[model samples]
Target: MYSSIYTESKEMYDELKEWRRELHKTPELGLELPQTVSFVKNKLTELGIPFETKVNGNCIVGYLGSGERCLLLRADMDGLPMFEESQLSYASQNGNMHACGHDIHTTALLGAAKLLKKHEQDLKGKIKLLFQPGEETFEGARAVIKEGILENPKVDAAFAVHVASTLPVKTIAYGTLTATSVFGFKITITGKGTHGAMPQNGIDPINVGVTIYQALQELIARECAPSKEVSLTIGQFNSGTMNNVIPETAVLQGTLRTFDSETKQYLITRIKEIVKNISKAFRAESKIEVLTDIPVLCCDEKRNEEIVKALNLMNAELKIISGLHTTGSDDFAVYANEVPASYFMIGAKENSNTIYAHHNPKVCFNEQVLPIAAAVYACTALDWK
Candidate 1:
């Protein structure tokens, strides 16, 4: 039953690897991905697939088949700002890195597109391919929606696959709440600057920044329920420009993650209050801003069951991982929030080499999982009821 799926996917395995390598060599960042966009466009054109560029985004959407029911499959096309140290022959010479395996995501979707286009006549419904950018900045999916990528035919359901670093190849992992909702915030504290010799003359924004940080931690510890999960991290703190001179302003940036919506809102509300009160006590004026707030990605139970059944036909293991949720966030939440959506993780761990986590300079991915992911995406789109 699954012979044809694997055979077709295997045929594109070489092309998929080449695409992944080429993309790995030239990783682009944020909303503007000129080279990445061009590469994907050329491939779509070569496949004789009809597509539209910039559904008001720095991305492209390809369409195949015709029917009342439409399904959207998404692939994020952005790279992190970190430098690569993997030292592979195809390793990026440029500073940017595809440390999160987005290159694999893009290529797998392309592979599935090729497969689906060849069998388009057999398909009963329409398939919309969303090649999105700026996922790293958590703005791509929202931008795709803003540009109306889900309209015209109006998507009924959606699907996406993210690569997993630790799970072994060919393993499929998913859950009800796959990931936590996250909010990125920045707090700026302003105070009087003074020479180090005259400490009393300065309001000391650095001291205020540290106090706020500690207070934020306490909010997590004391206010949050012991059974619930929430994380608050201060990733960046910038203050003094010199040893003797106290900087007039201190900037604090961090992230908040929670699994429940009420907890998420409560944390955000408390965070603002904590920062405001702490700064006021230190006699410093402060402002807090939320850079981005991505909702928790919840898989549609019906859609997830359909995907799991479809994948099982290809002889894949569908693992319902419990209490293994990730703190990291994805803008795919934006799409899932709008439609019946399901996102799965494809295990790509190659045990021989040292495993480096995502966003690390030395991160590596198992290319062998490329065809598996392609097959799963194609089969899920094709076999869904």
Candidate 2:
């Protein structure tokens, strides 16, 4: 009943692609998406749809129809803080880029919005469109929820889509449970500076830093459970400015990911202990700070089944994947924690070896799947009873 809604509007697919391309050309970052927000608001107005803006900074919410079985569909609107490297005519300007395919996600939601508005009479319940910002920093979803976007209408089911490059085109894959907990840690060690010739005059911060890193490695490799997948990576390390002189302090920054809350907590505790012990052995003072903490994302099995059924009816390829959690994390888990939710991936890769991963300046997606994504999103909402 839903797939037929777009039969005569095939041209809208091209129009949507152009819109996506335009968004890609002028990318905005985090909660500061004025241009993007204005564009979405303008589109809703053009279609005669009603919407509310700035529930949370750049986030925009729109409502269609009136029913008790409320469904929430979300799309991220912010771009990365990196510069664009792709040579496409629609490449990002102003040094902001959609390295994570949020442009496509936003466009697909818009396409779905158009179709849903046209078929508003056939809908059984209310549908809330969440155009969220600051996803790159993992703050938008929580902000929007805190602003009462979910409480006012009280969503029964929520769905979100991410464009994936690993899966083939026209194929949709979703993990029943995805990694939800992610944390960033900053370890700073302070020691006494010394001249190169004096071995005992002062403590060397770099040496202490290295020892702490090795200790952390052992903690993860030997202490953590073998079955649990966890990552402890030190992405940045800085100390000393001169070759002959020791620096007083060294900094270590990295991220940690886990699927379980207990394991996540254990990891954090172990990291602190390791750093403390290492610093004591070197007679240095150390501090460990947690920058961010996100819970794990678990898809509602019932909602997932409904989504699969809808996709099947639309003649779309579907695959159920397990243990496919990436090191990356999303604040979308914040909403999933409170309500039944499903986050699906849309294939964006065109070639096996040529596609780049997310957060890279060169990352790009296959625009041809925009319509397919929009169709799936619309169909899922249509079937959500």
- Identify the leading candidate in terms of TM-score: 1
Tens digit of per-residue lDDT, candidate 1, span 1-385: 4548767898778889999999999999989999999999999999999999873437999998888999999999899998899989999988999999999999999999998888887777999988999899998888888888889989999999999887888777887788889799999999999998898999999999999999998998999987788888998999997999988999999999888999888888888888888888989999998888999999898778777777777664544343337877899999999999988888888676578778889888899889989988888888755
Which pairs of residues collide in model 1? Answer: none
Q: What TM-scores do the predictions have?
A: 0.96, 0.92
Screening candidate 2 with a backbone cut-off below 3 angstroms (N, C-alpha, C), the clashing residue pairs are: 180-295, 180-296, 180-297
Model 2 lDDT, full chain set: 0.82
| Residue 200 displacement (Å), model 2 | 4.2
Cα lDDT tens digits for candidate 2, 39-73: 99988889888988774448888888788889999
The C-alpha RMSD in Å for every predicted model, in order, reads 1.6, 2.3
Model 2 TM-score is 0.92
> Model 1 shows how many backbone clashes?
0
